[model samples]
Target: MTTYIPSLTIPSVVLQHSAASVLLPIALGTAVGFGTRPSKTQKTYLALKQPPLRPPPWVFGPVWTVLYGVMGYASHRIATIGLRSSASPAIVETAQNSLTLYTVQLGLNLAWMPLFFVAKRPSEASIDIVTLIGMNAYLAYLWSSIDEVAAWCQVPYLGWLGFATYLCVGAGYLNGWDLHDKEVKEE
Candidate 1:
């Protein structure tokens, strides 16, 4: 006889209720982006170190919406492409490498919004952005290996990473993410 133990996970039936893998990550990612977004005050809060020069509050949602959509689709393509192709073993390693980079970048993408927007800690977000920069570079490198178009699709994402990095650094300079008692908690 053996003792039985329960698992601490959702059943497969609940874990995947649809084919919209892209939706789950995308919407949540966008929401994280949304949650971190600043109003005039937060941007003003950011003005302590340098020129605010922040975009209008209205622009954030729409721009992030489009970017999130593209990122999700690109990620879907990256995750799904090989399943449809029965390639030889020689190319499998290459595919795996590209996939690895793509996945890492995706994780970094998911991380950034929460750190910047929700936590309101640009310093932590700055740290995350460095990872984003590295991950984006790897993803781009992997993209070049697969196809020019796939690589090209990631270009805007890279630009976004760069812009976001600049914003994070500037914001951190102004607000000091380590400000207040918030630093006691893990961001």
Candidate 2:
């Protein structure tokens, strides 16, 4: 006997759930990450020797704004599917794990800016970014099993994470800062 899996079909209710379920976290993370950038942090970022393909600082805000919005929708899609398929324990379990992974990645995303820009420690930021990339990959893989569109939505986010990793590694290497040093000198 062969078992067949059904593809998820988007329902009209997704429109209702997308805004609150998706946008809220994306907006909150974006606000906290960008809001924490003070003049000192800006200066620190400017002083760093960026990687070869690093885009101008201005590009990040806009790029993240768009990416976050799309990410929210994609997440909402998965959530809606899970809710509709609540009768199936296996599907519910997968959905729960999927959302948990998304939340973990977002938390890491929120933490990166403060650690890198505000704290002026690219070493820690590098570690966070690396973890973020891994989480993103895992999320994408898990999401693909349930929803191909949702999985594809993470493409740009994944690409940006790669670029961010390059930037973080470059900054950490060039600065030669000691991760164990607890002292943060004011500029």
Candidate 3:
């Protein structure tokens, strides 16, 4: 089976720096999380019939913050070490492909908030999260060859995505796949 590799949207030079790479996802995630209107999102969240073991709303912020930072640092490592001049061409190619996957998955990660919260479309959100998980899993595998630590960084994100999938599917199932009907007050 042939695997499809995505082109990197962010320049490799930009990602080589630790601060830029680490902060990119964190900044974007914060922007999206706040931009979506937290108050309304919270209201909608409270109204939904969540499944067992769902974390409280406040927990998500801290958890995501840490995950973003870790994943960002991982990307930095991959770009810095794997793309170094002495590395083989094959390693360099893999690193570039890994970063491309990372960038795309990060975008998907950011999009999930709007789909689930703003649009109130749990079904679509579920699909997005599922896809994100699959892509990240493959990304981690690719990173393993170039940089082990970089690959390890994906562990936390992947673990959270697994739990998130359960929460998303559970909420969709419990709410009849319609968050709009929930009694959240209009802004």
Candidate 4:
């Protein structure tokens, strides 16, 4: 009988240098936000209308983990891109503009957790959701302005936020829209 030897296969290191910088903040946001507050109900609700193409609940964790990693590193890539670029002034200006928008949106993305989970205010969360949606929209526009590869990374996030907006709107209405409004007016 002939003995067979098996070879181990190692995956190629396709990730670029900028991957860590871009994805770090995203991962930080996730860990900080989730660790600060647990939202069992919210997670379930968010998954309610999840598209058929979307991954399962368990899949979200790992997928987002990797995505955020890429995002953080990619952000660093963009930040340094123009700094070291030998390109024209116009090109550098474009890179600067893109980075500004990306950074701003990332802040807004990070803000959603506090508004939604810690505050436990669906109405406030709904407003934040709208704001985050707009932020993502601007980020998308900025991505298109800078590089397709970078902008494409946000597609899954935007889609989740889209469904999340609807859930927040529904929950906001369900929780109490006018109660807080009346109190605000009284004050």
Candidate 5:
């Protein structure tokens, strides 16, 4: 009788090194954003009174796609530093903390879509976005200690977060979204 053995498949270097630390977040974010972007959300967005500097809706996808790619690359670089043979204990701790915070910020990023689009709660979205901007800035500082170029790469993401924060605030105000009352009718 022949026995069948299942072999465990180990992740490739690229997958272990970059894809998990980098691409996973981007892919998850993209999937969440795309999945929640239904026609109701589109109509709500189109009907909202935008801030003065709001980019066209079409601009968001491409910009985010590029930003996500850049963010992944930056994260990959940081992860590589953590994998160094000569890495000190403190360095490893810092890298681990930075990566953990990065994941938190990514969660905050994902939270915004559902809050704004699915729940149709601009006020809540605004608050979430504000927190995201702050966390992102802190993450940038943490990444700076590990990789200067990686830190610099997050600048655009920060700028975009700032802009998104502005938009959220504007949308909340223009729509008369009461934070305390999610069921309040739009003005």
Candidate 6:
């Protein structure tokens, strides 16, 4: 795996502390959630022809909040514990690479709402989520060799992403791959 990508990787200094690392994703996720306009997103969500087993719209907020925190802590663990555990250059490089992938996956995670709700593009949203799942799965695998706790922390996130992928694709299929028609206007 590549150790670093200037664009995709967050600088190590910003995430050096445990609290900063843990709060980073949570804060970003919250901003994205609000920035996309939740009322509009919720309206759009309800307007769609949803697939079976879809959770109520309210469920997403808490679930994502928790997932973001967990994933953030996982990244912290990978960066600190993983790095301190080994003096080897390869291990240090892997930790950096894992953090890079974490940032990339986070971008993908933040993109889903805008794609699905704001842009009203279910097909693109589904594709984005599928890609997110694949990237995070690989990320978790990388984390395993560095920090066991960090690797384990990703299990819930990976599980949730699997279910979310199903929801995205299923919603797309149910709605004929077009969320544009389902767009709801606010008063």
CA-only RMSD, every prediction: 7.7, 7.1, 2.6, 14.8, 8.1, 2.2
Candidate 5 C-alpha lDDT tens digits along 22-89: 66666877798778855555666777777788777778777887888777777777777854668888
lDDT per residue, candidate 6, 1-187, as tens digits? 3434655787676666888888899899899999999887888788888778889999999999999999988888877765675547888878877888899899999999888888888889888998998898899899899888888898999899999988888888988888776866666
Query: lDDT tens string, model 1, 93-112?
Result: 55455555555566667776
The local distance difference test score of each candidate is 0.57, 0.74, 0.90, 0.56, 0.73, 0.85
Better of 3 and 5 by TM-score: 3
Q: TM-scores of the models, in the given order?
A: 0.68, 0.81, 0.94, 0.65, 0.82, 0.92
Roughly what TM-score does model 4 have, to 2 decimal places? 0.65
Residue range 1-187, candidate 3, lDDT tens digits: 2254454457778789889988998999999999999987888888899999988899999999999999999999999998999999999989888888788899899999999988889999999999999999999999999989999999999999999999999999999999887856665
- What does the lDDT come to for candidate 2? 0.74
Note the residue pairs that clash in candidate 1: 36-117
Highest lDDT among the candidates is held by which one?
3
RMSD of 2: 7.1
Order of quality (lDDT) = 3, 6, 2, 5, 1, 4
Q: Which stretches of candidate 5 lie over 4 Å from their true place?
A: 1-16, 19-22, 178-187
Clashes of each: 1, 0, 0, 15, 0, 0
Residues 1-187 of candidate 2 have per-residue lDDT tens digits of 2122112222335433868756766677668865885555555666666668767767877788888887888788778776464437777668667776777687788888888776777788899999998988999888887789989999999998898898889877876753334233575
TM-score of 3: 0.94
lDDT of 4 by residue, 122-148 (tens): 677777778877876776666565566
Model 2 residue runs over 4 Å out of place are 1-16, 178-187
TM-score preference between candidates 4 and 5, better one: 5
Q: Least lDDT summed over 10 consecutive residues: which range in candidate 5?
A: 1-10
lDDT of 3: 0.90
Candidate 1: minimum summed lDDT over ten consecutive residues — where? 1-10
